[model samples]
Target chain A: MAGRKFFGHAEPREIVAFLTGGIFGSGLLVSGMIDTKKVQGWLDFFGAWDPTLAFVLGGAVLPMLFVWRIAEKRKVSVLGTPIPPRPAPKMDPALIAGSLMFGAGWGLAGLCPGPALASFAIGGWGGALFFLSMVSGMIVAPTVAGWLSSRTTS
Target chain B: MIPQDWIWGALGGLMIGGAAAIYLLVNGRIMGASGILGGLVDGTGRDSMVERLAFLFGTLAVPPLLVPLYHSVDTHITTNPGIIIAAGLLVGVGTRLANGCTSGHGVCGISRLAPRGLGSTALYLLGGAVTVFVFRHVLGVI
Candidate 1:
């Protein structure tokens, strides 16, 4: 079973990823991170503010710091695939602008992609609208960026 | 009763990090939601479709199962159709352009101390704060 493959590839890793996703979703649900009201409450600084999200961010980051360190020392992941390279460390305009836009969106809806999709089971029509529009935006992002680039250049 | 705010938040964060750690260590992939989903739809990540789908399947499947068990699964998402659509499109375009989102850049990227991740996180946080400020305070919209 150690070297066995499913569909000509390692199926166990896929299973692992699937299970990991389940854990991730359950974590979101259990932590109440999937709630738009909580998200908005955290962002509403000048109003009735909730500092809990800050703690959530902090909590999530602490362990991953160690994981990254361990990952760096190994060329291949535990499952035998090449580890992904560190992304180029630059503060380019695209990164800044894109993040800014996403943040605004997050602030507006109290939803990011993770919780948006995770909340779908209960989010109902509202979730469907957001999910559909989001996919549409993803599909058109390349073209929009291209258009913006051309306009700037010309 | 549900757990305290900070307690559950931190614990959840740990689970999120653990999931990400598992993904990285075992699959050698970053578990950013947008990047994973984007790759599947945008044709750039076709090579890893099976893995991505597996990951997504797990992500989407678990929450509903846990809904009854957890008293805190409430999302309270906005009911306004316009805002939802707008927010969704902005998130879609912005995250794709920026190359990551909360899970990817905010959580995974910042943890690794990557400049891109840090920069993106800061800008988004700033963006979120300002938007909230303007909308909630200035315009009185929420």
Candidate 2:
């Protein structure tokens, strides 16, 4: 039942998602596109800017489109299991609230989850701090949000 | 070893990707960095504590070992540690509120063509655009 709901009860959706993310991350690296400096510089458009980042994203995406097409045509689960695509979200308050918070954080830190994790390799106090706080945030926010949701629902 | 500049970005992405793959293959998990780190601190997932800690440390440490191979990147960041921490906290909040981060939703979820990921990634992009505008333009951080 659960399988059918999310991925057609055939293939393990988690495996598919994991491989998808792995390939995507690999794509980021191959393109030299995961660099926060590159990402930040791209964000710094109009001043000291390098717009090559868009090309990187495009390059990564174009290949992904082909992969998706092949996967769809085969209709065989990525892991030989039936999988249904997960549901998309509606434009609601959660998106609004989340987007605002994410934007504020990313704009300031210039370190989203991907680049922040990547930062750890550089042996900087900055990466350590970012990871620590990000971990903390991960632990704390969910519990607090869950509590808040319970209260609201109740 | 490797060249400078690309060390952190390349090594980090590979390690993270490798970990994600292992988790999926072994535990049937997606290996979202945020989710793993969160599970580590809060014990949200069913994995044993030792495994979780190992996973967390592996995620955090492997990349640093490769530092000798890469050069430093010149990105603009405030020297203020306080601001960086605060920003991380806010991102954490945002991830929880959104139910996933870029890896979880943007890469993993979107790759699966999940609808939630599509909506979430769109918002994430928009939010990123708006924040950059505010910081670099309105606030003139640059």
- Candidate with top DockQ is 1
DockQ of each: 0.71, 0.26
Each model's iRMS: 1.9, 6.1
How many clashing pairs per prediction, in order? 0, 17
Q: How high is each candidate's TM-score? A: 0.93, 0.67
Question: Considering every candidate listed, which one attains the maximal TM-score?
Answer: 1
The sequence of per-residue lDDT tens digits that candidate 1 reaches over residues A1-154 is: 3224323575888789789889888777767788888888888878899887877888889999999999989978998998889876776556767899999999988889888777888888888898898999899989877876676656
Q: Which regions of candidate 1 are displaced past 4 Å? A: A1-10, A151-154, B1-3
Tens-digit lDDT track of model 2 for A40-136? 5656655566555455433333333444445456544434533234354465455556656765677677777755654455526776787678777
- Candidate 2: list runs displaced more than 4 Å: A1-35, A44-49, A52-92, A121-123, A143-154, B1-27, B48-55, B71-76
Say which candidate scores most in lDDT.
1
Q: For residues B34-104, could you state the per-residue lDDT of candidate 2 as single tens digits?
A: 66556656666544334444444444444444446546433245567987798788788787677677666
Candidate 1 global CA lDDT score: 0.85
Q: Model 2: how far is B129 from its true place, Å? A: 1.7
- Distance from true location, Cα of B142 in model 2, Å: 4.9
